[model samples]
Target chain A: MQPVAPSLRRKPTVMSLLARFAWLPLCFVLVGCHIDMYDQPKYRPNRPSDFFEDGRSMRPPVENTVAMGSFEADSALFTGRLNGELAVDLPMELTADLLERGQTRYEAFCAPCHGLAGDGNGVIAYRGPLQVPTLHNDRLRTVAIGYYFDVITNGINRMYSYAHRIPPEDRWAVAAYVRALQLSQNVDADTLTAEERALLGGP
Target chain B: MSAQIFSRNANAILLVSIAAIVLLIVGIISALIGLYLSPWYTGVGDAIEQPVPFSHKHHVDQLMIDCRYCHSTVERVAHAGIPSTDTCMSCHSQIWTNSPLLQPVRDSYQTGEPVLWNRVYDLPDFVYFNHSVHVAKGIGCASCHGRIDQQHLTAKAQPLYMGWCLGCHRAPEEHIRPRDEVFNMAYEPQMMPIADRLALVQEYQIPVDGRLTHCYTCHR
Candidate 1:
C-alpha cells in the first residue's frame, strides 16, 4: 500500500486545528452578547407625583396641629374624630365613671411612658434622653384636654403617634386620667367643708 | 482484502452509532414521560394530617358561624390570626361544657399557653398575604379559602398559587362592595351596577396580567 502523503495529512491536521481555534472568539461573543442584553440596567419612568407630598415615601403627612373641624364640643363622644378639630368642655367635677375609664386607658397607653405615679420616671422616659414631662408639672396640668388629645394623636416632638395603636375614644379617656392625677396632687385646701377639714386634721 | 477490513470497520462504527441512537431515544422518552406523567418527579405534594381534627364545616356550616369569629384579626391586621384560647372558651366554655373536645381548651387555659394549632392553609413563606385587605374587599372567605364551612376537618381547601390570587386581584372592582359588607358572604350591591364595578377596577389600575408577580410582593 502507498504511504499517505505528508502534505495531505498536514493539510487536514491544520484545518482541524484552525476550526478548533475559531470557536474561541465565537464563544466569547455569544457570552458577551447575552451579558450585555440581560445584565443592563432596566429603564424606569420618573414620576414625581408618585411620591408623598410630605416627602415621606411610606407615611402619610403628619398633622402637627389640630384642625378646627376635628373638635366636637357637645357631641358627647369624647373620642376625637380623626383629622378633625380638637374640642374641649371642662366639667367641674370628674365622675367615678370618667376616672375609672381614664385609669384603664392610662395603664394601657400612658403608664408605659408616664410612670404609674404620673412622675416623669417611666421606664422608657428614664432610659431615653427624651424628657417626657411629669403630670405633676404645671406645664402639663394647665394644658387643656384638647391639647392633650392633640399630643396623643399627633405625638409631641420626640414621641410617635399612638393613633394607630390606641383608638380615638381611648385618647380622651387618657386625658381624663391625667386631669385626675393633677387634681389628686394639687388639691385646693380651701374648698373642703368643715367636716372634711376636720377629717384632714386641718384648722 | 482491504475492502473487507474497511467494511468491518464501517460495520463496527454503524453498530456503535445505532446503539448510541437507541440510547439517546430511550433517554429522551424517559425524560419526557418523567416531566409529564411520572408522579415521583413532583415535589412535596403530600397533605400533612393536623393534630386536632378541627372541623371548619361544623363551625362554619352547621353552626353558621362566620370565619371572622375565630380568625378575628382578618379584618384589621395582616394575618387572619388563629383564635386565642379565650375565643374558643367563649363558646366552648358554655356550649360544650362536658365534651372531650373541650379538653384542649381547658388544657391551653390551665397551661396559660396558646394552642400551637397546626397551620392548614399555609402559603409559601414568600407571600405577604394581608387578610384585612381581602376581608375589606367584598371577597368572601370562601372565594379563596374554598368551602371551608363544608369540611369536617379543615385541610387546605385551596392550592393558593399566584394565578389563584391574580384571578381576583386583577379585577378587584368586580369583587368590590360597600366596606361594611366586606366580610358578608351574602352582600349584594344596591347602588353600583356591574359596569360601575368594572370601571372602578380600571380606575384604580388594579394589577392584571400577574405582572406584579415579583418576589417582594409576597416575600420580604
Candidate 2:
C-alpha cells in the first residue's frame, strides 16, 4: 500500500462517533414514552381497613347490632331477618329439635372456645392463650338471649365477629341452646314439684 | 469502486433479511402453540371428567330446579359444595327410586359415602372464595360459572382465574343487584341500568383494584 500525505489522513474522533450513533437518543425517548403510559399506580384488591378515623366510631352500636334477633315493640315475636323489626317472645316450652339445632350450631361455631359441656375449658381456651368465659356460670345464665346473641355477633372484647361465619338464624339457635344449658344446670331445688321429682327419679 | 460498495451493501441487507425471516417464523409457530395449549393464553377449560356423571343440565334445565337446590351451601359458605348423598336421597329416593341413573346416589347412601364430584369451575386453591358474599351481593351464577344450567355435563365455561374474578370484584356495581336478584340475570336490567350500577359500585367503594391478587386471599 502507498503511504498517504499526512494532511489528507483522518481519524475517528468523538464528533464522528456522535454522528454514527445519533439514533440512540431518539430510540431512548421512544422507549421512555411507551413505558410511561403504563407506569401509573395499579388497583389493589383486599386493602386493609384504614383505622385512623378518630372522629368516626370504631365499633357499631350495641343494641341495634345484636348478633341475631333484636326485640321490636311492634310485633311480640323474635324475628330472624337481618333488619326485621319484631318483639322478643320467649318460647313457652323448649323443644328438643330446637336444642339439637342449637347444639349443632354451637359446636360448629363456639365449641372451639366454649367447651362441649358449656365449660370454658375448650381446646382453644385450654391450649390457646385466650381466657374464654364458661357458660356454666350464674352470671351467664341471667344474661338475656338478645345479649348473648349480641356478644356472639359483635364480639365483646378479644373475640371477632362470628357473624361472617354463622348465619343469623343459627346464631339465635345457638343462643337458645345456651339458655337451655343454663336452665339445665341452674334449676332451683325449690322449684322442683312432685311431678318433676318423680320424673327426676327422686323419692 | 462503486460496484464493490453496491455488492457489500447488498450482502449485508440480504444477511439481515434472512435473520429477520427466521425469527418471524419461529415467533409465529411458538405463539400459535402457546395459544392452543396454555391456560394462561386461552383461559381454563373443564374437559376433565368427574367420577360420576352428574348433569346440571338435567337437574337445572330440564327439571327447572335451582342450582342452590343441589349446591345448597352457595348462599352461606365459601364453597357451593357438592350435595351429600343424604341430600340426594331426600328427593331421589322417592322420585327416581327405580331409575338406573339413581344407582350411584343410592349406592352412596347405602354405603354412607359421598360422591366425589370433580370440581369444574375451581379457582386456584389460594383464592378465598365465598359463594354467600357473592350471592348476597347480587352476582348471578351465570356471570362467572357461565350458563351452568344449560351445561348438561357441567363443563367449566369461564376461566375462573384471578384476573377473571378481579374484573368483577373491582367493579361489582356493574354486576350487582338486590339480594333476591343476586342469582337472577334477568332481574339485573330492571334493578338498575349498567351506568347506574357502575356508579353504585363506585359509590359503595366496591374494590376494583387487583390488590386482591395477594396470595393469602385466595390461597389461605
Native-vs-model 1 lDDT? 0.61
Could you list the CA RMSD of all candidates, in the order they appear?
Answer: 19.1, 18.6
DockQ of all predictions against the true structure, Cα-based: 0.02, 0.02
Q: What would the TM-scores of all predictions be?
A: 0.43, 0.47
Candidate 1 C-alpha lDDT tens digits along A115-182 = 77788665545544446677897777776577777777777665555665445565677778888888
For candidate 2, the per-residue lDDT at A124 reads: 52
Show model 2 residue runs off by greater than 4 Å. A1-203, B1-48, B185-191, B199-205, B208-220
lDDT per residue for candidate 2 within B86-186, as digits (tens), equals: 65664454454777877888887887544555545534333457777777666778777666766767666675546667666555666676554545533
- B90-173: candidate 1 lDDT, tens digit per residue: 445434567686687778777754455655555544456887766655556756665556667655555565766765655565
Clash number for model 1?
A: 9
lDDT tens digits by residue: candidate 2, A1-203: 34579888888899999999999999988877644322323212212224524221223246546544444433223333223422143432457877786876676456656777787765556644557777887667665566666666667665655554455566677888888777876787679887887787756
TM-score of chain A of each: 0.50, 0.50
**Chain A TM-score for predicted structure 1:** 0.50
